[model samples]
Target: MPLMLPFAVEELEVFGKCTSGMWVYARNSTGSRSGDKIVKRDIDLCDEHGRVCVRLKGLSFREAEADRNPNPGATFPETLESFMLEPVWKPQAVHTEGESLGYARHLVILCGMTGFSSRDTAKRPGGMQFVQLELSQPDIAERFHACADQVFEMIRDLLTEKPQERVLLQVVVPSQGDQQLFAGLTGLLQSAELEHARLIGQTIILDTDIKFEELVAILEENKISREKRIRYQKGQRFGLSWNELDAKEGDVPVPWKDEGVYLISGGTGGLGFIFAHDILRQTKRSTLVLVGRSALSPDKRTRIQELSDAGAKVVYKQVDVAMEDATHALIGEILRDYGKLDGILHSAGVIKDNYLVNKTTEEMQEVLAPKVRGLVNLDEATKELPLDFFILFSSLASTAGSAGQADYAMANAFMDAYATYRNSLIKTLYRHGHTLSIHWPYWKEGGMKVDAETEKMTLQKYGITAMQASTGISALYRGLASGKSEVLVMEGELTRIRQHLLSEAMEQVIPPTAVSEIKESSSTLVETELDTGNLTDKVLIALKLEVSKLLKIQSGAIDVDLEFNQYGFDSIT
Candidate 1:
């Protein structure tokens, strides 16, 4: 007795046989029929050359069972297995390696479901029925040869078994609303870290009652253009001109005095010390309060004593800002001892590097505690104080979304957002207080643990030059004085930074002409050779040209000795 296929074969085309005895064929068929009417239509299978083979008419379990011979029946295979059927035509010559076979041999798996029925049974209504289509790719199938039997069993179960209602409803009615399916899909694609397999999963929401043809059309469109499924966001770049730097120095006053009390979190760290020393230098009588999780070392204590002797009181306190009660108590103690709270600088944060999938909830919270919760605690404790500045130290990762730094990025992004929110409130409640979040690039001396190899790769491949302590401090001061709620400080050639950021879909945020000018300036330093007089003249001419362009005036109207403020330039510009 001959075996019967579950579905009707409509057409078939044989390409040729490979040396390995594997016969490649294309198939076109329809799925199961309901009451003599075809349910699934235009199901196609072809090779890279567009040759069709094994086309089927329709699929029906009832029809297939009826066609089977009852008396000659034998036990069926428990697993879905492949068996060769005699070719409808003579085999053609074997093709050479790398030859086009006329069909898509690749397979993409999209797994997700849409709303079928509400939990409320009264809302149930009749909907369109769908016929299942089974398609396979030889290349993909070969990859799972070791688990062939298991794969076959899974397919058999899918076709013949009924899942629990709860399990079935999960795919149909996911906890995350259907409207957000696209966002979830793009996120999955972006976060995937596939090394060998070119597979990605995405979610699509469809009405349960959608026509079968429409569903097939949607799947086909996505299959043909996978790139469209991934989404990207635009990012921003920040820079300062030589003229702006000079203007910032003259316009925005630090307002630091010998009697003011300034607090620095993470003060025992390298960056904290630098800021502490700079604050001392800026004022003759100000008091510096440095907070860290550990006690100051003997050497650090001696250094603090020196600053104390220099007339600025230096105090070091051991405190973890993440402890809300402890941070609040510490703030109260400072206010009591100093009679005032002049400023607060938050530089406390932690980092745990791992791929998003591998990151644990505890690790994320550990990083977020000091950065996000600490800020909230500090702000609540000092809400009534007339502070000069409230500065939060953030990172460039918040903007660029660096791979393996999701937790760190999320914490910093919170800081960025909170700073903006605080600034909005400050305009009304504490007009004298400024809330600023500074997004900084890599610092050569002070940062989370970074080995030499990683640093070298970051600089060479990513075009990111770690900021020198002196330059970073200068930029920090300028950023604070600029009166902006948020600022990003970056160090690199603009063109190189732009190129590096292209993968993040943020390259276009920076103007091309600005990058060109920066590139040209750096190139000029290497290529130009001139005498002292000629170089001085060239420098003066370039300065005048830049000023003219900035002021929107002719170069002839610029005077080298005139201050920028005289040309209608202010800190806002």
Candidate 2:
């Protein structure tokens, strides 16, 4: 089966009438259809008059092989569940107390808040209600995260009033769920909300464009279940799901280069050093450049010495990826020293898990800077330094949603999209090397997991047995060879794993995007001619409100004429 993932679709610049119909043409932007490919072109729907009536811009298609279908047989038949339901949990602490809580790397509940009332029952007859949130509007793409901030805040406040009550948050996302990175913000937010909801109370999300009667049926169903629910807005999709590396692929020699200089961000600890050991031992002649924000600890120095004793060169750069200047300078220095960079392994990330109510904007950024902003910086610095491959170490949380990890989920989600974006650039710009993002499952070690009990609980809850170092290392090599933009390693059988994931109550046919109905998505929204090219006042107002909601600030503060950078645009990534 053919598969398509639309990165962005704005039917902008529609003018001529298509009543008589128009020709729909898809040109393979990539000259050759070999291995992994990305198709970027303007699909103009023109009428008999040869006038462009409808235009679709920036939608990309990637192939697993021969313009390959990454997950050949995985996609939903009836597309775009514009309206669906999702479940969430509230936070235990106040909305403004994150910096104080010093949240643990893993799940942690907020406490010490007053004025919240507890009650029985997650929902009642009248309690089965919802609020509309349209996060799919194209114009807000630049400020999507800012917009997400507002939605999450609203969720925080709504649930804050009555922590023990169950409320449904009706969410509107583009047909492309997680693949459409901007719209995926809602997925991350819902996941984060659910994360918090699991800790506090109940706040669910629903994305629908169905008839009101159908919605009523869903509501009645909600009333009956008394259990939390979240409709999979996007259809059946499988591109982001990673496959376990069979012994053959894992046994294939790793992507090692003799005398190659490899850069590993977030390379100081956990998987970083583990890879360093592999590279030094396997790629004995290569120079491993490790990047981390922390100073070298004595224990780390000893490990480096051991690797050095093995033969390869090991160097560490204490720099924060969030700081572009420092990051760029480090890359620059590396290029100067090594003449040419062979590969990049971006595994740098930070975790600050807290419920939405307790997490402040600063806290959110704190978690995002390393993965989101930092990746942008890395891209800017390395865009000129073409090499073999650019590997991003992503997480399953972005796919499954993590409580108290909206920022983290949002960041990784961005990475998932960025990998595809970078690959498109590679094809169009004639850049060397491919970009692959491996959305990994929980590792048996170094995921900041200290206790064995927590690991066991993870298995019990998600049916995800922690991955061993050897297995993950082999999977990493297999992902590098896969050629696809993103490979989310799916461990075990889907049938059994689905059982555990359903325990999280998030196993709907999460809509599979372009393969679904874009028409249905646009037709359902009544007062919003969102898909049109001519940007209207209502559209602008809606966008302003979107950002305003995210910032929890006044819409008036956003000047339409001002450059987005003037308002601190770097954080938007």
Candidate 3:
């Protein structure tokens, strides 16, 4: 083994490639055999195992230090309480010296961790090697490597950048087992007469008996005032605790997720556009796929071009989930493009004023196709994508009944039941984070009303349209992207309706006066269906007028009584 050098190496990243599962491909700057400037190399850590693990390549010690202290506005790990922060390695080009030139700093860090792994079995993953530990644990049967003590030695070995600088370890003892082990280790170190090894807070605080005084000395030595370092430490403490904002779960930290994907329906619609835009802005190197029925308009094409320019990798396709073939084709395309799908947001549906009894069978199918059949279609299409989430965009009307919207309400109710069943199935298959069913209250704008007349109805009824002339595909996309099932009810009649729904569901207490008043309400509020085969002006007027009234707006004024449009709407009534 090489002579030990005291170099400060506190900030460490544990990234490895899974040979059998996932591997990172590195581009060589200079190829020895092919004379190629860029050559691909598979960086798998293990071979013949279930998974190959690989570490990050070409990390320089100097660059790692800079990365650890990136800027004045750097974000630190919330779990770290009061520890020295410095990068163990930095990003750089790999030299011809191979492992000898590249992993010098990494090797040092590995040495400290090895020491810890040598003692305990649980802390160590099997098949790892160290300079001192040749003997493996006998009690362990599954590919046993070094114990926890060995891991600690490797970790401590890498913590020093300079002999003069002292390394501070911030150990988060979440469980009693960890706390007990740490205490035992500290006691053993003290008995061994090690010059270092001092207990600080709740855990073993090495290198400092009094952090306040030691921090002052460090600040003064490093040319920083005590007041500044104190403020900085206080700020860090505040931020670390701030992660406990939603402190329902214990203080024990959850491991960070490196990468994820979000699959959204109606991604090309107005709502989806907003969601994609925000995601592109918020996330790093995340791909957003927009699923919709309509082809991109020229204006939307421009937006997509902008997203592409911004390096969003935005993908859009016109596939109506109502069509089984289209849904199957979409699934195939997604699998081919991305190896696995992570999240899904179902936001495709159609809305029209058609009461169940009054609506013609054809008209009923037209509205229900997207909500009922389309939801099932989406479920089938996304079955293959190792789905992290399968969310449905249901409506509050699924809970609370709306007048003259029997078809729409029924469609939404089916959506609720379908979501519940699918969620149950997913839990049985792959139980993960809270699988949820979300219901969004009626939006004033967006696709809430597809046409200008629908817009008029919304304005008249609610006095404001929550929807954008375009739909809010993006908001729904965001809700699903977040891995939560939530009902985003706006702050108006929609909220009221949602509350009413919950109340009715819990108590079944429909007020008698309210029911009688509903019964006595104008019949115009009731939807009148049009007979598709029967040609009459009354049908046209009924369709438009009833729809308009439900929207709380006046019907469109036409000069002629009803003249039929191509889709069988009579203009000359």
What are the per-residue Cα lDDT tens digits for candidate 2 across 148-170? 56665765665466445334443
The prediction achieving the highest lDDT against the true structure is 2
Q: Which stretches of candidate 1 lie over 4 Å from their true place?
A: 1-252, 430-432, 449-457, 498-573
TM-score of 1: 0.48
List model 3 lDDT by residue over 215-293, tens digit each: 3232222221101011122212210110111212223321112244666787766556665666677666777778878
Error of 2 at 64 (Å): 44
Largest TM-score belongs to which candidate? 2
Q: Which regions of candidate 3 deviate over 4 angstroms?
A: 1-259, 355-358, 430-435, 449-488, 492-573
How close to the true structure is residue 421 of candidate 2, measured as C-alpha lDDT? Answer: 69
Residue 529's C-alpha lDDT in candidate 1?
27
Off by over 4 Å in 2: 1-145, 163-180, 196-253, 457-463, 490-573
Specify the poorest-scoring 10-residue window by lDDT in model 1.
165-174
> Which prediction has more favorable TM-score, 1 or 2?
2
TM-score of each: 0.48, 0.55, 0.39
Better of 1 and 2 by lDDT: 2
lDDT of 2 at 297: 94
